[model samples]
Target: MSTTQNERLRGLLEPLVGAQGLDLEEIEVSQAGRRRVLRVVVDSDAGVDLDTVADVSRAISAKLDETDAMGEGEYVLEVGSPGADRPLTEHRHYVRATGRLAKLQLHEGGELVARILTVDDEGLDLEVPGVKGRKPTARRVGFGDIAKARVEVEFNRKNKQDELEQEEEEA
Candidate 1:
Protein backbone atom coordinates (compact mmCIF):
# COMPACT_ATOMS: atom_id res chain seq x y z
CA MET A 1 0.00 0.00 0.00
CA SER A 2 1.08 3.57 -0.60
CA THR A 3 2.29 5.81 2.22
CA THR A 4 -0.45 8.32 1.43
CA GLN A 5 -3.12 5.67 1.88
CA ASN A 6 -1.56 4.60 5.17
CA GLU A 7 -1.40 8.19 6.44
CA ARG A 8 -4.98 8.83 5.35
CA LEU A 9 -6.13 5.68 7.11
CA ARG A 10 -4.16 6.64 10.21
CA GLY A 11 -5.77 10.06 10.21
CA LEU A 12 -9.19 8.50 9.80
CA LEU A 13 -8.81 5.80 12.43
CA GLU A 14 -6.65 7.43 15.11
CA PRO A 15 -9.43 9.54 16.59
CA LEU A 16 -11.88 6.62 16.57
CA VAL A 17 -9.39 4.38 18.32
CA GLY A 18 -8.37 7.14 20.75
CA ALA A 19 -12.04 7.69 21.65
CA GLN A 20 -12.04 4.12 22.96
CA GLY A 21 -9.03 4.94 25.21
CA LEU A 22 -6.37 3.29 23.07
CA ASP A 23 -3.38 4.47 21.11
CA LEU A 24 -3.30 3.48 17.47
CA GLU A 25 0.27 2.30 17.29
CA GLU A 26 0.45 1.31 13.63
CA ILE A 27 -1.62 0.89 10.48
CA GLU A 28 -0.40 -1.12 7.52
CA VAL A 29 -1.95 -2.48 4.36
CA SER A 30 -0.44 -5.39 2.50
CA GLN A 31 -1.51 -7.80 -0.18
CA ALA A 32 -2.28 -11.42 0.65
CA GLY A 33 -3.27 -13.65 -2.27
CA ARG A 34 -6.22 -12.03 -4.00
CA ARG A 35 -7.23 -9.88 -1.03
CA ARG A 36 -5.61 -7.13 1.03
CA VAL A 37 -5.02 -7.16 4.75
CA LEU A 38 -5.27 -3.94 6.73
CA ARG A 39 -3.64 -4.56 10.11
CA VAL A 40 -4.28 -2.05 12.88
CA VAL A 41 -2.11 -2.31 15.95
CA VAL A 42 -3.52 -0.62 19.06
CA ASP A 43 -2.47 -0.33 22.68
CA SER A 44 -3.29 1.40 25.98
CA ASP A 45 -1.50 2.10 29.27
CA ALA A 46 -3.60 -0.64 30.91
CA GLY A 47 -3.00 -2.87 27.87
CA VAL A 48 -5.72 -4.11 25.54
CA ASP A 49 -8.23 -6.87 26.20
CA LEU A 50 -10.10 -8.99 23.69
CA ASP A 51 -13.35 -7.14 24.45
CA THR A 52 -11.71 -3.77 23.79
CA VAL A 53 -10.23 -5.05 20.53
CA ALA A 54 -13.61 -6.28 19.44
CA ASP A 55 -15.24 -2.94 20.30
CA VAL A 56 -12.57 -0.95 18.47
CA SER A 57 -12.72 -3.28 15.51
CA ARG A 58 -16.47 -2.77 15.24
CA ALA A 59 -16.11 1.00 15.39
CA ILE A 60 -13.36 1.04 12.76
CA SER A 61 -15.26 -1.30 10.49
CA ALA A 62 -18.35 0.87 10.68
CA LYS A 63 -16.37 4.00 9.93
CA LEU A 64 -14.64 2.36 6.96
CA ASP A 65 -17.92 1.06 5.64
CA GLU A 66 -19.29 4.61 5.70
CA THR A 67 -16.28 5.86 3.77
CA ASP A 68 -14.53 4.60 0.64
CA ALA A 69 -11.21 4.64 2.42
CA MET A 70 -10.10 1.15 1.50
CA GLY A 71 -11.28 1.56 -2.10
CA GLU A 72 -13.40 -0.87 -4.15
CA GLY A 73 -11.77 -4.13 -3.17
CA GLU A 74 -11.87 -7.00 -0.70
CA TYR A 75 -9.87 -6.15 2.41
CA VAL A 76 -9.51 -7.73 5.83
CA LEU A 77 -9.48 -5.56 8.95
CA GLU A 78 -7.36 -7.00 11.73
CA VAL A 79 -7.21 -4.89 14.88
CA GLY A 80 -5.01 -6.12 17.72
CA SER A 81 -2.49 -5.14 20.40
CA PRO A 82 1.22 -4.69 19.77
CA GLY A 83 3.13 -7.86 20.50
CA ALA A 84 5.94 -8.19 23.07
CA ASP A 85 8.56 -8.40 20.30
CA ARG A 86 7.65 -5.04 18.74
CA PRO A 87 10.42 -2.42 18.62
CA LEU A 88 10.42 0.38 21.20
CA THR A 89 10.47 3.25 18.70
CA GLU A 90 8.43 5.90 20.51
CA HIS A 91 8.91 7.31 24.02
CA ARG A 92 5.48 5.98 24.92
CA HIS A 93 6.59 2.57 23.73
CA TYR A 94 9.55 2.63 26.12
CA VAL A 95 7.28 3.90 28.88
CA ARG A 96 4.85 1.05 28.29
CA ALA A 97 7.77 -1.38 28.42
CA THR A 98 8.85 -0.29 31.89
CA GLY A 99 9.77 -3.27 34.10
CA ARG A 100 10.51 -5.43 31.06
CA LEU A 101 13.91 -6.53 29.83
CA ALA A 102 14.98 -4.85 26.60
CA LYS A 103 17.70 -5.56 24.04
CA LEU A 104 19.04 -2.18 22.99
CA GLN A 105 21.32 -1.29 20.07
CA LEU A 106 23.38 1.79 20.82
CA HIS A 107 23.76 4.35 18.07
CA GLU A 108 27.42 5.02 18.83
CA GLY A 109 28.23 1.31 19.16
CA GLY A 110 27.56 -1.90 21.06
CA GLU A 111 24.43 -3.70 22.34
CA LEU A 112 23.12 -3.98 25.86
CA VAL A 113 20.29 -6.05 27.24
CA ALA A 114 18.93 -4.56 30.43
CA ARG A 115 15.76 -4.39 32.47
CA ILE A 116 14.00 -1.07 32.14
CA LEU A 117 13.76 0.85 35.42
CA THR A 118 12.02 4.08 34.43
CA VAL A 119 11.27 6.30 31.44
CA ASP A 120 11.29 10.08 31.09
CA ASP A 121 11.16 12.59 28.23
CA GLU A 122 14.93 12.68 27.81
CA GLY A 123 15.98 9.10 28.58
CA LEU A 124 15.45 6.01 30.74
CA ASP A 125 17.22 4.29 33.62
CA LEU A 126 18.12 0.65 33.09
CA GLU A 127 19.41 -2.04 35.41
CA VAL A 128 22.11 -3.91 33.60
CA PRO A 129 22.32 -7.49 34.80
CA GLY A 130 25.89 -8.17 35.83
CA VAL A 131 28.02 -10.85 34.26
CA LYS A 132 29.56 -13.91 35.96
CA GLY A 133 27.45 -13.63 39.14
CA ARG A 134 28.49 -10.04 39.74
CA LYS A 135 26.09 -7.44 41.17
CA PRO A 136 23.68 -5.80 38.74
CA THR A 137 24.56 -2.23 37.83
CA ALA A 138 22.39 0.76 36.89
CA ARG A 139 22.82 3.01 33.84
CA ARG A 140 21.06 5.80 32.04
CA VAL A 141 20.54 5.82 28.26
CA GLY A 142 19.20 8.70 26.27
CA PHE A 143 16.64 8.11 23.55
CA GLY A 144 18.96 9.44 20.87
CA ASP A 145 21.65 6.99 21.96
CA ILE A 146 19.36 4.08 21.19
CA ALA A 147 19.21 2.99 17.57
CA LYS A 148 16.92 0.05 18.16
CA ALA A 149 15.28 -1.65 21.14
CA ARG A 150 12.95 -4.59 21.63
CA VAL A 151 11.46 -6.16 24.71
CA GLU A 152 12.90 -9.54 25.64
CA VAL A 153 10.45 -12.21 26.72
CA GLU A 154 11.33 -14.33 29.73
CA PHE A 155 9.24 -17.51 29.68
CA ASN A 156 10.43 -18.99 32.99
CA ARG A 157 10.54 -15.73 34.92
CA LYS A 158 8.92 -15.31 38.35
CA ASN A 159 8.57 -12.19 40.48
CA LYS A 160 9.89 -12.39 44.06
CA GLN A 161 7.09 -10.21 45.41
CA ASP A 162 4.49 -12.32 43.65
CA GLU A 163 5.99 -15.50 45.03
CA LEU A 164 6.02 -14.09 48.58
CA GLU A 165 2.41 -12.93 48.25
CA GLN A 166 1.37 -16.36 47.04
CA GLU A 167 3.17 -18.05 49.91
CA GLU A 168 1.51 -15.74 52.42
CA GLU A 169 -1.94 -16.42 50.97
CA GLU A 170 -1.29 -20.15 51.02
CA ALA A 171 -0.20 -20.01 54.67
Candidate 2:
Protein backbone atom coordinates (compact mmCIF):
# COMPACT_ATOMS: atom_id res chain seq x y z
CA MET A 1 0.00 0.00 0.00
CA SER A 2 2.68 2.45 1.00
CA THR A 3 4.85 1.40 -1.92
CA THR A 4 2.09 2.01 -4.40
CA GLN A 5 1.38 5.44 -2.98
CA ASN A 6 5.05 6.33 -3.12
CA GLU A 7 5.31 5.13 -6.72
CA ARG A 8 2.27 7.14 -7.67
CA LEU A 9 3.84 10.14 -6.03
CA ARG A 10 7.05 9.50 -8.01
CA GLY A 11 5.02 9.23 -11.18
CA LEU A 12 3.43 12.57 -10.38
CA LEU A 13 6.75 14.28 -9.67
CA GLU A 14 8.94 12.91 -12.47
CA PRO A 15 7.60 15.20 -15.13
CA LEU A 16 8.18 18.18 -12.90
CA VAL A 17 11.73 17.02 -12.21
CA GLY A 18 12.41 16.46 -15.90
CA ALA A 19 11.11 19.90 -16.72
CA GLN A 20 13.56 21.34 -14.22
CA GLY A 21 16.50 19.28 -15.53
CA LEU A 22 16.78 17.04 -12.49
CA ASP A 23 16.85 13.29 -12.14
CA LEU A 24 14.42 11.61 -9.76
CA GLU A 25 16.50 9.41 -7.49
CA GLU A 26 14.12 8.41 -4.71
CA ILE A 27 10.78 9.24 -3.18
CA GLU A 28 9.41 8.50 0.28
CA VAL A 29 5.88 8.98 1.58
CA SER A 30 4.69 8.44 5.12
CA GLN A 31 1.56 9.20 7.04
CA ALA A 32 1.43 10.84 10.44
CA GLY A 33 -2.09 10.72 11.83
CA ARG A 34 -4.10 12.45 9.06
CA ARG A 35 -1.20 14.21 7.40
CA ARG A 36 0.96 12.77 4.69
CA VAL A 37 4.61 13.71 4.39
CA LEU A 38 6.17 13.30 0.98
CA ARG A 39 9.93 13.46 0.71
CA VAL A 40 11.25 13.59 -2.82
CA VAL A 41 14.93 13.07 -3.41
CA VAL A 42 16.35 14.30 -6.68
CA ASP A 43 19.81 14.55 -8.14
CA SER A 44 21.79 15.43 -11.24
CA ASP A 45 25.33 15.10 -12.50
CA ALA A 46 26.15 18.40 -10.77
CA GLY A 47 24.05 17.82 -7.63
CA VAL A 48 21.09 19.75 -6.15
CA ASP A 49 20.64 22.80 -3.91
CA LEU A 50 18.16 24.67 -1.72
CA ASP A 51 16.65 26.78 -4.52
CA THR A 52 16.14 23.76 -6.72
CA VAL A 53 14.65 21.86 -3.81
CA ALA A 54 12.25 24.70 -3.07
CA ASP A 55 11.30 24.90 -6.71
CA VAL A 56 10.62 21.17 -6.92
CA SER A 57 8.61 21.17 -3.69
CA ARG A 58 6.43 24.00 -4.90
CA ALA A 59 5.89 22.39 -8.27
CA ILE A 60 4.83 19.15 -6.65
CA SER A 61 2.52 20.93 -4.24
CA ALA A 62 0.83 22.83 -7.03
CA LYS A 63 0.38 19.73 -9.11
CA LEU A 64 -1.04 17.86 -6.15
CA ASP A 65 -3.41 20.71 -5.48
CA GLU A 66 -4.71 20.66 -9.04
CA THR A 67 -5.09 16.89 -9.17
CA ASP A 68 -5.93 16.27 -5.51
CA ALA A 69 -3.25 13.62 -5.84
CA MET A 70 -3.08 12.92 -2.13
CA GLY A 71 -6.86 12.34 -2.16
CA GLU A 72 -8.47 15.03 -0.02
CA GLY A 73 -5.79 15.07 2.66
CA GLU A 74 -3.14 17.63 3.40
CA TYR A 75 0.40 16.59 2.54
CA VAL A 76 3.67 18.24 3.42
CA LEU A 77 6.25 18.26 0.64
CA GLU A 78 10.00 18.02 1.11
CA VAL A 79 12.54 17.93 -1.63
CA GLY A 80 16.20 17.06 -1.03
CA SER A 81 19.47 15.82 -2.44
CA PRO A 82 20.66 12.24 -1.89
CA GLY A 83 23.22 13.52 0.63
CA ALA A 84 26.85 12.45 1.14
CA ASP A 85 25.81 8.90 2.00
CA ARG A 86 24.43 8.09 -1.47
CA PRO A 87 24.25 4.41 -2.25
CA LEU A 88 26.23 2.78 -5.05
CA THR A 89 23.94 0.72 -7.29
CA GLU A 90 24.02 1.99 -10.83
CA HIS A 91 27.17 1.68 -12.92
CA ARG A 92 27.45 5.44 -12.88
CA HIS A 93 27.80 5.43 -9.09
CA TYR A 94 30.79 3.12 -9.31
CA VAL A 95 32.15 5.20 -12.10
CA ARG A 96 31.72 8.27 -9.92
CA ALA A 97 33.64 6.65 -7.06
CA THR A 98 36.64 5.65 -9.11
CA GLY A 99 39.77 5.93 -6.91
CA ARG A 100 37.49 6.65 -3.91
CA LEU A 101 36.90 4.03 -1.20
CA ALA A 102 33.67 2.06 -0.87
CA LYS A 103 32.19 -0.66 1.32
CA LEU A 104 30.20 -3.40 -0.36
CA GLN A 105 27.93 -5.77 1.52
CA LEU A 106 27.40 -9.04 -0.24
CA HIS A 107 24.04 -10.78 -0.17
CA GLU A 108 25.69 -13.78 1.46
CA GLY A 109 27.05 -11.59 4.31
CA GLY A 110 30.54 -11.14 2.92
CA GLU A 111 32.15 -7.70 2.98
CA LEU A 112 34.47 -5.94 0.55
CA VAL A 113 35.91 -2.61 1.54
CA ALA A 114 38.23 -0.86 -0.87
CA ARG A 115 38.65 1.63 -3.65
CA ILE A 116 36.53 1.22 -6.76
CA LEU A 117 38.64 0.17 -9.73
CA THR A 118 36.05 -0.35 -12.44
CA VAL A 119 32.45 -1.28 -13.26
CA ASP A 120 31.26 -2.94 -16.40
CA ASP A 121 29.09 -5.76 -17.75
CA GLU A 122 31.45 -8.21 -16.03
CA GLY A 123 30.64 -6.37 -12.76
CA LEU A 124 32.71 -4.39 -10.28
CA ASP A 125 36.41 -4.76 -9.60
CA LEU A 126 37.42 -3.54 -6.15
CA GLU A 127 40.47 -3.55 -3.92
CA VAL A 128 39.69 -5.94 -1.07
CA PRO A 129 40.59 -5.80 2.59
CA GLY A 130 43.72 -7.44 4.02
CA VAL A 131 44.88 -8.42 7.51
CA LYS A 132 47.53 -6.68 9.57
CA GLY A 133 51.16 -6.76 8.25
CA ARG A 134 49.87 -7.80 4.81
CA LYS A 135 49.31 -5.68 1.71
CA PRO A 136 45.67 -5.10 0.71
CA THR A 137 44.05 -7.44 -1.77
CA ALA A 138 41.92 -6.71 -4.82
CA ARG A 139 38.79 -8.62 -5.80
CA ARG A 140 36.35 -8.79 -8.66
CA VAL A 141 32.80 -8.71 -7.27
CA GLY A 142 30.29 -10.28 -9.55
CA PHE A 143 27.03 -8.36 -9.52
CA GLY A 144 25.15 -11.18 -7.81
CA ASP A 145 26.82 -10.79 -4.41
CA ILE A 146 26.51 -7.04 -4.17
CA ALA A 147 23.58 -6.32 -1.89
CA LYS A 148 24.49 -2.78 -0.96
CA ALA A 149 27.41 -0.41 -1.50
CA ARG A 150 28.19 3.17 -0.57
CA VAL A 151 31.07 5.51 -1.22
CA GLU A 152 33.29 6.19 1.76
CA VAL A 153 33.56 9.95 1.32
CA GLU A 154 36.89 11.35 2.45
CA PHE A 155 36.16 14.84 3.69
CA ASN A 156 39.70 16.10 3.98
CA ARG A 157 40.68 15.06 0.49
CA LYS A 158 38.85 16.11 -2.70
CA ASN A 159 38.67 12.69 -4.36
CA LYS A 160 34.89 12.33 -4.35
CA GLN A 161 34.30 15.84 -5.59
CA ASP A 162 37.08 15.37 -8.09
CA GLU A 163 35.19 12.45 -9.61
CA LEU A 164 32.19 14.65 -10.26
CA GLU A 165 34.46 17.36 -11.60
CA GLN A 166 36.17 14.94 -13.93
CA GLU A 167 32.82 13.70 -15.15
CA GLU A 168 31.67 17.22 -15.86
CA GLU A 169 34.88 18.00 -17.69
CA GLU A 170 34.52 14.87 -19.78
CA ALA A 171 30.96 15.83 -20.51
Candidate 3:
Protein backbone atom coordinates (compact mmCIF):
# COMPACT_ATOMS: atom_id res chain seq x y z
CA MET A 1 0.00 0.00 0.00
CA SER A 2 1.06 3.57 -0.57
CA THR A 3 2.39 5.64 2.34
CA THR A 4 -0.62 7.94 2.24
CA GLN A 5 -3.00 5.00 2.26
CA ASN A 6 -1.22 3.44 5.19
CA GLU A 7 -1.34 6.68 7.13
CA ARG A 8 -5.00 7.11 6.34
CA LEU A 9 -5.73 3.60 7.46
CA ARG A 10 -3.82 4.17 10.67
CA GLY A 11 -5.73 7.33 11.36
CA LEU A 12 -9.04 5.66 10.63
CA LEU A 13 -8.33 2.53 12.64
CA GLU A 14 -6.34 3.85 15.57
CA PRO A 15 -9.32 5.56 17.17
CA LEU A 16 -11.45 2.49 16.69
CA VAL A 17 -8.81 0.30 18.25
CA GLY A 18 -8.18 2.69 21.16
CA ALA A 19 -11.89 2.88 21.83
CA GLN A 20 -11.82 -0.87 22.31
CA GLY A 21 -8.94 -0.56 24.83
CA LEU A 22 -6.24 -1.94 22.60
CA ASP A 23 -3.03 -0.42 21.39
CA LEU A 24 -2.61 -0.38 17.63
CA GLU A 25 0.74 -2.04 17.34
CA GLU A 26 0.93 -2.37 13.57
CA ILE A 27 -0.89 -2.13 10.25
CA GLU A 28 0.22 -3.94 7.13
CA VAL A 29 -1.22 -4.33 3.66
CA SER A 30 0.30 -6.99 1.47
CA GLN A 31 -0.44 -8.98 -1.65
CA ALA A 32 -1.25 -12.64 -1.38
CA GLY A 33 -1.87 -14.26 -4.73
CA ARG A 34 -4.80 -12.31 -6.26
CA ARG A 35 -6.08 -10.76 -3.06
CA ARG A 36 -4.66 -8.17 -0.71
CA VAL A 37 -4.18 -8.86 2.98
CA LEU A 38 -4.68 -6.31 5.71
CA ARG A 39 -3.12 -7.36 8.99
CA VAL A 40 -3.72 -5.39 12.17
CA VAL A 41 -1.77 -6.20 15.30
CA VAL A 42 -3.31 -5.02 18.57
CA ASP A 43 -2.10 -5.50 22.10
CA SER A 44 -2.56 -4.44 25.75
CA ASP A 45 -0.68 -4.80 29.02
CA ALA A 46 -3.20 -7.38 30.23
CA GLY A 47 -2.82 -9.31 26.95
CA VAL A 48 -5.40 -9.92 24.24
CA ASP A 49 -7.77 -12.87 23.90
CA LEU A 50 -9.38 -14.46 20.87
CA ASP A 51 -12.78 -13.01 21.70
CA THR A 52 -11.36 -9.49 21.74
CA VAL A 53 -9.65 -10.10 18.45
CA ALA A 54 -12.88 -11.32 16.94
CA ASP A 55 -14.76 -8.25 18.11
CA VAL A 56 -12.02 -5.95 16.86
CA SER A 57 -12.00 -7.74 13.51
CA ARG A 58 -15.75 -7.29 13.13
CA ALA A 59 -15.50 -3.61 14.01
CA ILE A 60 -12.64 -3.05 11.60
CA SER A 61 -14.51 -4.86 8.83
CA ALA A 62 -17.59 -2.77 9.40
CA LYS A 63 -15.59 0.44 9.44
CA LEU A 64 -13.84 -0.50 6.23
CA ASP A 65 -17.12 -1.38 4.60
CA GLU A 66 -18.43 2.06 5.51
CA THR A 67 -15.48 3.85 3.99
CA ASP A 68 -13.36 3.87 0.82
CA ALA A 69 -10.12 3.81 2.77
CA MET A 70 -9.24 0.45 1.29
CA GLY A 71 -9.48 1.86 -2.26
CA GLU A 72 -11.91 -0.72 -3.67
CA GLY A 73 -9.65 -3.74 -3.61
CA GLU A 74 -10.58 -7.15 -2.26
CA TYR A 75 -8.60 -7.62 0.93
CA VAL A 76 -8.68 -10.12 3.75
CA LEU A 77 -8.63 -8.60 7.23
CA GLU A 78 -6.60 -10.34 9.90
CA VAL A 79 -6.66 -8.86 13.40
CA GLY A 80 -4.49 -10.36 16.10
CA SER A 81 -1.99 -9.78 18.89
CA PRO A 82 1.73 -9.73 18.57
CA GLY A 83 3.36 -13.14 18.82
CA ALA A 84 5.56 -14.07 21.79
CA ASP A 85 8.67 -13.45 19.75
CA ARG A 86 7.68 -10.00 18.57
CA PRO A 87 10.38 -7.38 19.18
CA LEU A 88 10.02 -5.18 22.25
CA THR A 89 10.09 -1.72 20.68
CA GLU A 90 8.19 0.28 23.27
CA HIS A 91 8.29 0.83 27.03
CA ARG A 92 4.85 -0.69 27.34
CA HIS A 93 6.10 -3.80 25.57
CA TYR A 94 8.79 -4.20 28.17
CA VAL A 95 6.32 -3.53 30.96
CA ARG A 96 4.01 -6.23 29.69
CA ALA A 97 6.99 -8.55 29.45
CA THR A 98 7.74 -8.40 33.15
CA GLY A 99 8.70 -11.82 34.53
CA ARG A 100 9.42 -13.03 30.98
CA LEU A 101 12.78 -13.83 29.49
CA ALA A 102 14.11 -11.51 26.82
CA LYS A 103 17.21 -11.42 24.66
CA LEU A 104 18.53 -7.91 24.58
CA GLN A 105 21.15 -6.45 22.25
CA LEU A 106 22.93 -3.44 23.66
CA HIS A 107 23.80 -0.46 21.54
CA GLU A 108 27.29 -0.24 23.01
CA GLY A 109 28.14 -3.80 21.99
CA GLY A 110 26.94 -6.93 23.76
CA GLU A 111 23.93 -9.21 23.97
CA LEU A 112 22.39 -11.05 26.91
CA VAL A 113 19.35 -13.10 27.72
CA ALA A 114 17.74 -12.06 30.98
CA ARG A 115 14.45 -12.30 32.80
CA ILE A 116 12.72 -8.95 33.08
CA LEU A 117 12.06 -8.15 36.72
CA THR A 118 10.61 -4.65 36.47
CA VAL A 119 10.14 -1.82 34.05
CA ASP A 120 10.18 1.88 34.87
CA ASP A 121 10.16 4.98 32.72
CA GLU A 122 13.91 5.00 32.27
CA GLY A 123 14.88 1.32 32.06
CA LEU A 124 14.49 -2.31 33.08
CA ASP A 125 15.69 -4.33 36.06
CA LEU A 126 16.77 -7.70 34.76
CA GLU A 127 17.91 -10.92 36.33
CA VAL A 128 20.65 -12.35 34.17
CA PRO A 129 20.92 -16.04 34.76
CA GLY A 130 24.38 -17.25 35.51
CA VAL A 131 26.32 -20.00 33.80
CA LYS A 132 27.30 -23.39 35.32
CA GLY A 133 24.61 -23.44 38.03
CA ARG A 134 25.67 -20.08 39.42
CA LYS A 135 23.22 -17.65 40.95
CA PRO A 136 21.54 -15.11 38.70
CA THR A 137 22.75 -11.53 38.88
CA ALA A 138 20.75 -8.33 38.84
CA ARG A 139 21.49 -5.80 36.13
CA ARG A 140 20.07 -2.48 35.11
CA VAL A 141 19.56 -1.61 31.46
CA GLY A 142 18.20 1.69 30.28
CA PHE A 143 15.82 1.69 27.34
CA GLY A 144 18.28 3.69 25.29
CA ASP A 145 21.00 1.09 25.83
CA ILE A 146 18.97 -1.57 24.12
CA ALA A 147 19.47 -1.75 20.37
CA LYS A 148 16.91 -4.52 20.08
CA ALA A 149 15.00 -6.91 22.34
CA ARG A 150 12.54 -9.76 22.02
CA VAL A 151 10.84 -12.14 24.43
CA GLU A 152 12.34 -15.62 24.38
CA VAL A 153 10.05 -18.63 24.49
CA GLU A 154 10.87 -21.22 27.09
CA PHE A 155 9.29 -24.63 26.65
CA ASN A 156 10.25 -25.97 30.08
CA ARG A 157 9.56 -22.96 32.22
CA LYS A 158 7.49 -23.86 35.26
CA ASN A 159 4.18 -22.15 35.91
CA LYS A 160 3.06 -20.70 39.24
CA GLN A 161 0.98 -23.77 40.09
CA ASP A 162 3.89 -26.09 39.46
CA GLU A 163 6.20 -23.94 41.55
CA LEU A 164 3.68 -23.82 44.37
CA GLU A 165 3.33 -27.60 44.29
CA GLN A 166 7.07 -28.00 44.48
CA GLU A 167 7.27 -25.69 47.46
CA GLU A 168 4.50 -27.60 49.24
CA GLU A 169 6.30 -30.87 48.62
CA GLU A 170 9.52 -29.46 50.05
CA ALA A 171 7.72 -28.07 53.06
Best by lDDT: 3
Return the lDDT, model 3, position 138: 100
- Alpha-carbon TM-score of each model against the true structure: 0.93, 0.76, 0.94
User: Per-residue CA lDDT of candidate 1, range 1-171, in tens?
Assistant: 788898899999999999999999999899999999999999999999999999999999999999999999999999999997889999999999999999999999999999999999999999999999999999999999999999998897679898899899999
Q: Any runs in candidate 3 off by more than 4 Å, and if so which?
A: 167-171
lDDT of each: 0.95, 0.80, 0.96
Task: Sort by lDDT, best first.
Answer: 3, 1, 2
Q: Which parts of model 2 have CA positions greater than 4 angstroms off?
A: 129-137, 158-171
- Can you give the lDDT of residue 167 in candidate 2? 94
Over the full model, what C-alpha lDDT does candidate 3 score relative to the true structure?
0.96
In what order do the candidates fall by TM-score, top score first? 3, 1, 2
Best by TM-score: 3
Cα deviation of 132 in candidate 3 (Å)?
0.9
Residue 111 alpha-carbon offset, candidate 2, angstroms: 1.0
RMSD of 3: 1.4
Of the two candidates 1 and 2, the one with more favorable TM-score, higher being better, is 1
